[model samples]
Target: MMTMHPQTPDILPRVAFVATGGTIAGTMTEDSKTSWAYSSAQRSGESLVMGIPGLLRRAQWHFEQPYSIGSQNLELGHMLQLRAVLLRLLESPEIDSIIVTHGTDTMEDMLYFLHLTVPSHALGKPVLFTGSMLPSDHEQADGPGNISGAFEFLIQCLSTNADVSGHSAMPFGLCMQGLFTPAHRVEKQSTAGLDAFDGPYSVLANTQWLLSRNALEMSEDSGVQGQFASLFDPTATRHPLFEAMEVPVVFCTPGNGPLRQLTDLLNRKPASVVVAAPGHGNIPEACVPVLRRLLLNGVSVVRASRVIAGGVEQGGEFDALDAFRQAPVQGGNAVFSEAGGLNLSKCVMYERLRVLAHSLSV
Candidate 1:
């Protein structure tokens, strides 16, 4: 643990910053090694902090770069590894806050994963996730301002133990552009704008944002059945990417042509299947038989919408399909529990954690 001093500089909060490569660390290059426009993770976390005007003296910092690849290249294993890093950092008493700089493309996945895996009681301090749409070298890059907002939010959380509006905030949140939103309610609104999110209603850091559903439904609980309260366990051996690709997500497209075949499930039934069903989670009637067979054989299924904003409804298209009673996996205790009111992307994450947690203890 880093010891605190009673002097002037030491009074600034101590921060643990993890830089997982995203556009915020990107740089333009002619090489074909990186994704889309430029090479991400071209810059290091320490360099990002040191280059930011007036940020060098704000805090005592510890930096680590777990990946420098683009966000599209980041996989499930990376998230689990990052979770382990966060748990380790949370153990240090001298650390007042933690921040992760990532790519905006999948920033919500990182944020929501932390929200689900790390509960309030486990948080002695707090963690913030931030990233930008444009590369760090862009003339009007948003990464620096976003990162600055992270530090400002940390100062308030440490000093007042409350948000800018003087209300308590959740342990996991995202600070970006000019807004601060608790992790659970965050959403990316556009790909073209700097202030591209659609939650939180403030210019300064705050968590008074509203949610569409009951608070109780948005679980901060760990794996299924309290499974030791969280998957953020730093000590347990991990199955980071264990069978991550097996839980197939089938998309519901227009027209009733033969849907994608699931003959593979008959031989090696996945623990779960997340269907990105058409409008309001209407699972096409054609695929019903195979799904039912899988269900009886101990495979789980979740119905979700492909639409960006709305959620799938109960009794959507088929009454029988809408109601799900799942069974445990063949050899593992994980269950891809039925849930509602989450977008398709979020549903994928929710089920992944549910089914994956038991493979290796969460």
Candidate 2:
């Protein structure tokens, strides 16, 4: 059930805490030192909020638990449902921002999905994602600290209207270890470490601890927002890709066997096929012929890199291929951004193609 926190003085900003249950809400084992072996979704959003010391006083807050499952079980349907809720919340005049507690495993993918599907016009408000590496009941549980830190970050942004890029609006972000990282740049690096997430390609919003020994430290203005508006039109009538009947992602390797494997994936008639190519989005020379055939047949084959940084550049083997030489291949460059680090562009491209395919069918 959803519940609203009492509004504070009119001067304070109102925030909505939407808990989608992750390790942050997980129960601790008897030993207390180990958090891996526990029941997820064991706690509610209200309970988690109350656990944060002095958090209720920081802002006017509301709580909702739309779904309480480990991120490993998250499906496309869940993302679609979340998007609907977010759209509704963003429309409210009372809510100033949103904080989502998610499981770490699929957090980045969810952020990417939301980054593409959420309407740009409604993105004026901030949406922050945070979760804990340890369970709530653990002695040094990081969930309360993370939530409090994120709350502080959001409160400060309430008066900020400037976008970091100065061109597009940045409506979404994540806070880890008190560092305000844009959503597209954040990547989970450790499974159990308290400070597990980091921004790969961008500078830290604030390197110093925001909340040390319960003392609050506000983040400095980075003058940057995740420029999501450039990815798609705010007025576009595209449906959520997760709602699509099928969206398969096929991985491509550099072996001679990749040609046959790639052919088999194309025969399935997927909405899109993303090749996890080697460095710089290079497909195996042997596999180029098969990719060309599929492209000729109107299949959307995106060339994505398996490496972590520096996105696929244009004019490579892909450019020399028959399909790309004649016309541009549906590569992963469209999703690349300075703030979008590595895997984000590829993830967004996969779902973007899926959404385009669904729009055509409808």
Worst lDDT window (10 residues) for model 1?
220-229
Write one digit per residue (lDDT tens) for candidate 1, span 109-176.
76676666654545556688899887887777788888998877776656654432322343466788
The TM-score values for the models, in the order shown, are 0.81, 0.75
Stretches of candidate 2 above 4 Å error? 1-12, 30-36, 159-171, 201-242, 245-247, 254-257, 317-322, 325-345, 348-362
Worst 10 residues of 2 by lDDT: 213-222
The candidate that achieves the highest lDDT relative to the unseen native structure: 1
Model 2, 1-362: lDDT tens per residue?
Answer: 12223335655668899999988899966754453477777898889988877777777778877789999998766776677677777778777789999988888777766655565566767688888887888777888888887776665555553342321333366776777655544567666577677644323333232222122211221112222334334333344543553444445654556677678866776555566677777777777677666665555566667776666655566553533433334642122111112363335444454446445545
Q: What TM-score quantifies how close candidate 1 is to the native fold?
A: 0.81
Candidate 2 accuracy as TM-score:
0.75
